[model samples]
Target: MQHAIHPAYGPVVFRDKAADFAFLTRSTLGSDRTVEWEDGRTYPVVDVEISSASHPFHTGTARVLDAAGRVERFEWRYGREAA
Candidate 1:
């Protein structure tokens, strides 16, 4: 309820580089870069490295780790000593 104390909140475009995905949403984040959207409006564009679109879990391409093999290797080298 304060005046001129809050950050500007408006449309912001989030871009995912790996997945090549971009979406517009309201946010307080600001950027110097701008891009012309499909709606013929320019908004601040923010570049992101990863998101749900490109993440392995969301894409169903997550790699399963071999815990047994890692434990065997550790024991073989450390001789079961709790360090």
Candidate 2:
């Protein structure tokens, strides 16, 4: 909590463009972008690629990993001799 030593901690908007999602939270991160929120207040907007709203795992859209297929591919490439 030393003065002038730490980055400013304040409200920042994280925007997920793909899902059209945004949320306000306090953090040390920031961006040059700005956005007016529902409350009619402008906040620093940070664009993100994914968030809980768009993430496959969080939204139940996740694809099952093909573990067996990967194992077979690895075996094929390296052979069983590669223990």
Candidate 3:
């Protein structure tokens, strides 16, 4: 653990606007935005597009691609040439 060589590690709030979720954790990243946490202290806030709360895979909202339909389209386009 070297002193004065490492970036400042402090509490930061990562906010997911889509999901309207925010969590506090230690980070070396800095932000100009700030938010008052539940502890009554202001912390640096970072906006994020997606998080586990809003991610399709995590929330089981992921759409499955139709491989059969794609195969059918490919066959319709190229199958006649081979025949």
Best by TM-score: 1
lDDT of 2 by residue, 1-83 (tens): 56899998899999999999999999999898899999999999999898999999999989998999999999898889733
lDDT of 1 by residue, 35-68 (tens): 8898999999999999889989999999999999
Sliding window of 10 residues with minimal summed lDDT for model 1:
74-83
What's the lDDT for all of these models?
Answer: 0.94, 0.93, 0.95
Q: What's model 3's TM-score?
A: 0.81
Clashing residue pairs in candidate 1 are: none
Off by over 4 Å in 1: none
Better of 1 and 2 by lDDT: 1
Sort all candidates by TM-score, best to worst: 1, 3, 2
- Give all TM-scores, in the order shown: 0.85, 0.80, 0.81
